[model samples]
Target chain A: MNTPNTSPSPEVTRTYRRLIPNTWWLKQRSTILFMIREWSSVFVALYAICLLGQLWALSEGPERYNALLAKSLSGGSLLLHLVMGAFVLYHMVTWFKISGRIFGSGPLSPGAVTAVNYVVWIAASIGVFYWIF
Target chain B: MCLIKFIKSLEPLWWSLFGLGGAIAAFLFPAHILIQGVLIPAGILPKDMLQYENFAGLLSSPIVRIYFLALIVFPLYHAAHRIRMTLEDLRIGWLNAILPLLCYGGATTISIAAVVVILRLS
Candidate 1:
């Protein structure tokens, strides 16, 4: 079969192997964003680990829990939390954006699915903030 | 490779956890991080937000405990799934063999620890 490859032997067929680099996601803006969205889950898990530690300390006693709180309120922790919060925010947005497709065209449109997710997310955030602060 | 194949066959289980965890992360994590991380730490909110007595009371409530458990547990699996897949994407040779066990196993271990902690909270 004739093809558009400017080759001396166009009739020859070969396998197509996807040779991608470790940093292949870096090649494009969308891929970079996609990788970041996927990769930031590590930090998300770290924060959960930290939360677990806090609970463990709480189970231990008030003294230990308060001490942990003191550390959590430090400048370093504030910085780390800021970073973690941003990553989680990104995770939320990306996940919800993709969440709409879960409905397909069955009943709710993709935009409706995404909108409902965002609405619920905002309500949950507000409820949490009210409970805490 | 029997063990590896067995784990590979459990992809749907891992994927289901990932979606559940993703939903939890989206709805809850940012708010907790914003309050516990940003507000209290920066002194924008009163310190009692994390006062041990208040927090302990919160933990005593079964609802809060369940919420905390969900918060502390599921996102871990979500993260583990992502991490394992990312390692696979990197095309590392030996890593492909161990990544699933290492990542999901780590998540399972931590989740168990969290449950123990919550169960023992007084």
Candidate 2:
């Protein structure tokens, strides 16, 4: 067995340790899923940026805003949205499943929290839809 | 040392933002995506609904302003955090010191811009 060096090794040249595989996340199903879930953020960030652009366009006035809106509705943007939407949907679904872990596992159970999450989500979205359209 | 400690202390802040953003993203983003991506594209929701006048009018409401602000901003920080973690998971250890700063800084800058835009929209 190699003995531990309690003292500092300022003068000693330490050998480089073997690095973790870049694909280490692929070793486990959960880790792979988590990585994919994390990837959803890229799309989220893209959409957020686009929305900010829309806000800027709104600030610009009706003509520019209309142009931006038209661009967003074009074929390219639609395809982008479909792809991004899939990722975001995956993100949302996984998030609901694990939200209890984030907020703290309080008196309410995870399942209950998830149920409440879905309920609130549906209600709020419907409310927003009504308010907006 | 103090600077390091300060940076270290930001962990909780980042984590909290990540959780909050995740919650918002899960709860509200789907509806927005469906409307903007599917309904609007398919013409089921008339293009007029997204017209400048209509959208601007919709955003003029205080509640809608707040909702849009939240919707646009939180996910940014959340994405930053996730991107940082994803990089770490990729075994990019050399970037440890700078990654958080870059990611969170970008998110902060954009969030501030978003807030300003939302505030000025009315």
Candidate 3:
């Protein structure tokens, strides 16, 4: 059975989308940094995995652990670490700076928040150094 | 009773881990990276500083074990969440149904592995 078509059509058809260009995120400086920050977590995860690998090596014995550490000290590993370090550091600083916005906006100043964040971080670093040394 | 609804309900949980992980990454990851990456390679720090025995001795403390747990686990979730979102942003929306499970599931598995390694170290 066929029924008569009942759908109404506008005289002029309109599509609603405002197409986002592939480069939309790259158009802004802040967004460029934002994408970098977002992408840096992969390196952080890689670092974590490296640490886990070291833990497994340590479990196997000092010989295996030392071998792993030596590999970590190799030129290739050092360069990889340096690249990852730069990315992760960028991630951390940007993350700290934007934390105020994450919690809420228009209450506490971001400057004050950033200052506090750095201060505590410095203190923690000092404590770690004291413990390690 | 679809997977999307299931994932939506867990949003808060993953987001909380994301926040915590971000903070911990700020705290420890950079310093370790600098030490292991630049300073040691540049010879500013002694190689013996990270020797297996010395590092093991450092990890022997229970408190340090907990810190290690935080360092390893939190960042897994953070990376998972970020990567999943980035994939979505890249127009892989059709995969959305399985993305959450794949991302968060991978993180959970790694987190468990990290916990097991930490316990062994302790």
The lDDT for every candidate, in the order shown, is 0.88, 0.83, 0.82
lDDT of 2 by residue, B1-122 (tens): 45545655799999988888887877777787788877898788888788777888888898988878888889998999999888976877778767777788899999999988887887
Task: Report residue A55 deviation for candidate 1 (angstroms).
Answer: 0.3
Worst 10 residues of 3 chain B by lDDT: B88-97
C-alpha TM-score for every candidate = 0.89, 0.87, 0.87
- Model 2 off-target regions past 4 Å? A1-18, A100-108, B1-5
lDDT of 3 by residue, B1-122 (tens): 37657876899999999988888888778777787777887788888878887888988889888887888899989999998888777666468668888888899899998888888887
In lDDT terms, which candidate is top? 1
**Would you list the clashing residue pairs of candidate 1?**
none
Model 2 chain A worst lDDT window (10 residues): A1-10
How well docked is model 2, in DockQ terms?
A: 0.75
- In model 3, chain B matches the true chain B with a TM-score of 0.91
* lDDT value for model 2: 0.83
Comparing 2 with 3 on lDDT, the higher-scoring candidate is 2
How well does candidate 3 score on lDDT at residue B107?
90
Looking at model 1 chain B, report the run of 10 residues with the lowest lDDT sum: B1-10
Weakest 10 consecutive residues of candidate 3 chain A by summed lDDT: A6-15
